[model samples]
Target: MPVTHTYNEEHYCKSKRERRNHRMKVGFIGTGSMGGLLIDAFLSSGGLLAGDVIASNRSPQKLARLAQLHPGITLAESNGETASRSDILFLCVKPMEFKTLTDEIAHCLRSEQIVVSITSPVQIYHLESVLPSKIAKIIPSITHSVYSGTSLCVLGSRLEADDRTQLLKLMSHIGTPVEIYEHHTRISSDFSSCGPAFLSYFIERWIEAAVEATGIDHTLAGKLAGEMLLGTGKLLTEGEFTPQQLQDRVAVPGGITAEALNHLRCSLDGVFERLIATTHKKYDEDVAKLDSLFGRDGITRRK
Candidate 1:
């Protein structure tokens, strides 16, 4: 079944029909995982037409794949060309490559153009330093491939009201856009961006345990787990029941579910605390390296 758009999303698309018909161009400087996912989401959602996108990537094969997937999208030969041509540009390259990629296209960027970075470490401060255009950082999630999940957005000071509105509106078509501060980037990304893999790992282990312990078919266990996860996400997002409330409803006192919960509580105590601490530590190290590379005192001075 195809996903239906919200009323607001439908209205937004209808309002932008003239712009789409006139061929408003959205450029992507890299056609990697997140970038490619975004392109597909936007097109599939009717937020942007295939002909309205112009993309370029370091690898020719990626561009070729995108061209095959979306026939009308123009593939630029270089990052600078894509930057120069787009009304709104997405920099989807790695965090380390931000400086080089921005420098490559800085000369061609226009004052009115919207420049967005998809990575978390390369803050808007870094982008604003070189980009002449409006800048922002939007941390996307893997779950957005299914048009679900939250996207963390940190708008730069230079971004105008109109630009911010447009950006958020576009993002809304793919996922709920949550405006956040730069300081919250890492923790928010841990929840929204890195969360899918982390949650999936636990679910995978759960499936494995069920197969190993009960002699259930691995395939059947995986299928059941996946459907349960999907339904659980829906229940949480629907806002009728809090996690604890849901658990209370499902796990009667001394029930199997309650026993399982107790086992999980004992086994997983301090696990997430360490997980978050470890990720934050790595984040700080990455920020320090980026600081050294970009010659900023630190995030403090940049802010």
Candidate 2:
């Protein structure tokens, strides 16, 4: 028996047309290093057109450079105007500036628009108090410019399903979008968003030691270490090999790798423990400081 299938050409054509003409308005309130990187990544991802991006920064010099880099990006007259013109707004200012920036643009934020906090310490409460609706947070990485990073997102209370889907679609083109709880935002941000710099710092230290110990050129030592780390990253991400498994694989019972591993274990006993603990504690303290400023109401600043 032959089954006859009906082709809905009109529906298919309409979908194609929508995809061809779709565009979203994006706004950035700060245009610093992280802020500027995001704009470039977003535009390059083709999620949003450069002309639809509205950028505003405190520094005219930075704005001038950004405009030179991407002339299509709209330079808004004010933060409020940027918020007013955007369907999705990103606050890239410092955490301390969150309250002030929110106060500045709150009146301009439409009820239907989404305001995302790209900085830490500012929570949903702080954003909701003034913006009243669609308050969300994201911790995106500088590595997003390379299209390989983790973007930790915490959705707002009123965000629509369609909106979340659209956001994921736009962001995932640049990096992996992972939803995280606000309580774990600090740890997650530290591990993914802030991990690159921390890793690079250690790599530099290792490279210096390798050059000194082996009498190899610093350039060659650094390149070797970098390639090893890059391959390890791929194996961890693409292969089934766990960090512990890979370590044990190289650290055979009494091999040279084992000796090196043993020294690392002894040397790093409480160093990483305290370092990580301090990171979490610092984040909590900063959040507490911001909370004190906003009080329970999250609007009134501390005198």
Candidate 3:
């Protein structure tokens, strides 16, 4: 079915030449947290100008919020308009919305236009079946907001060498893009994407303990823990110190650090075992659901 669209002509990039003239036209179908962060990072990368970007969201409140932040950006009137007007379209909606959103706007996409899915459940084959375009899938982290975060990219069948090169060139400014097979995208995503939040939560608990143990304020304790983590990260990246060597450098035998480390370390074997098993099992189940959604029968419900 042909999708109906409404757009302000001044905001839409209509032609191939226009999309390619200086910077590529970038369209965002959803302007929620992840979408907004990515738009910020991409603009910071200098690969795109504010005028080259187009955005649309179902929620008026989100549109209002995004407008306050990016006053010069073009807000499309509808999803179909956003899909039809850009060289690269980023679908940043939630996982549950992917199938329905794609089904709605896929017909509006041009064959040469590239559709990139940031949501995990939206697989490449599903996109290929729905849209007449090249597809790229990425799992984004909140860290990308910092412009130094790592992201994983698993390309669809249609994206060629030049497409990959252009995409990587634009993506590299935001973070390191490690290309991997589609199957690996999920677990690697779990690590690089979820690691920051998970580790932050872990750090928060330690910070609370530090505050209680020393009577320091939570803010000061947090700063202390954060600075140590920053330095530790630098050390680990700068040198080839093995985990044992790093531990030894800090915790002497019979010392307070070692005493605590020994206790935590003993518990970690089972803790981490459960963490691994649970994470993998959940991701595997999600992938299986995606398979069912995109299976030959096309019988699956999106949500």
Candidate 4:
């Protein structure tokens, strides 16, 4: 049966009048996995009109597929065209493609344009040097597609207050947008960008171990692990407990939880600490390489 809303005449009229309209010209240079996800979220948010969004990619086939999927989105012939047409241009290409792509579209960029770089390791300063335009850097998680993610946005030195506000408003629809210093973008990338993969890896290992120990079906183990993780996340968010506090609550004195934790810690030998340390080191190294290629000291000067 089809559902229908029963509304009073006055309330229905007021509701119709209160409907908001938003139209922005947004363009994306890369329509890969993350880029496609962003586009999906933007459209789902209702502020952006289909006709106002455009995208361009190196592969014609990819562009064609996107255009077909999103009939409202325009397909730009090249990066230059995308930059020229968009009020807010998302440089979604890989870090390796940054220099070449920015150089190609730099001349086409306007002073009024809002350029956002989603590539990691390439700092805002490097993007500014290459494009010489108003820019911002954003580190967004995959969860952004579901409007439940977290994002860290760093404004460029040249960005105006209004431009920053607009950017924040747009991104807030997709996730929680925190205004952060550009120097901390690397740290944000560690938690907000790369965190999902790290969490997934740990969950996969736990599920495998559970299967091995209990001889349970692998699918059931996987489902249980996923649900438990989701519930744990909700507990952390809704309950006012620090991670250590939560662990203490679970690890009752002389309980099985405590025993298991003790055994795991001893067997792992500071595994979590090593994982974080190694990840940060690799990120720093990648940032150093990017700085070297772009001729900058680094995103943050470590004392």
Highest TM-score, which number?
Answer: 1
**Alpha-carbon runs more than 4 Å astray in model 1:** 1-23, 297-303
TM-scores across all candidates? 0.90, 0.89, 0.87, 0.86
- Residue-level lDDT tens digits of model 3 in 38-62: 8888777776778988999988788
Q: Once model 3 is optimally superposed onto the true structure by TM-score, how far is the C-alpha of residue 156 displaced, in angstroms? A: 1.3
Error of 1 at 300 (Å): 5.8
1-303 in candidate 4: lDDT tens per residue? 121222222422233235233345799999998788888888887656679798999888878887777787898877877887677899888887787887687777766678998866777777776665688988778988778768889888789998889899999889889888776776677778888898899888887888889899999888888788777877778877787888899999999999999998889898867877787787678777767777765344432
The 10 consecutive residues of candidate 1 with the worst lDDT sum are 1-10
Off by over 4 Å in 4: 1-22, 296-303
lDDT by residue for model 2 (9-62), tens: 243223545745756678999999889989989888876788889988887889
Q: In the order shown, what is each candidate's alpha-carbon RMSD? A: 8.1, 9.7, 3.7, 10.6
Residue pair clashes in candidate 4: none
When summed lDDT is taken over every stretch of 10 residues in candidate 2, the lowest stretch is: 1-10
Question: Any idea what lDDT model 3 has?
Answer: 0.79
Which pairs clash (backbone N, Cα, C closer than 3 Å) in model 3?
none
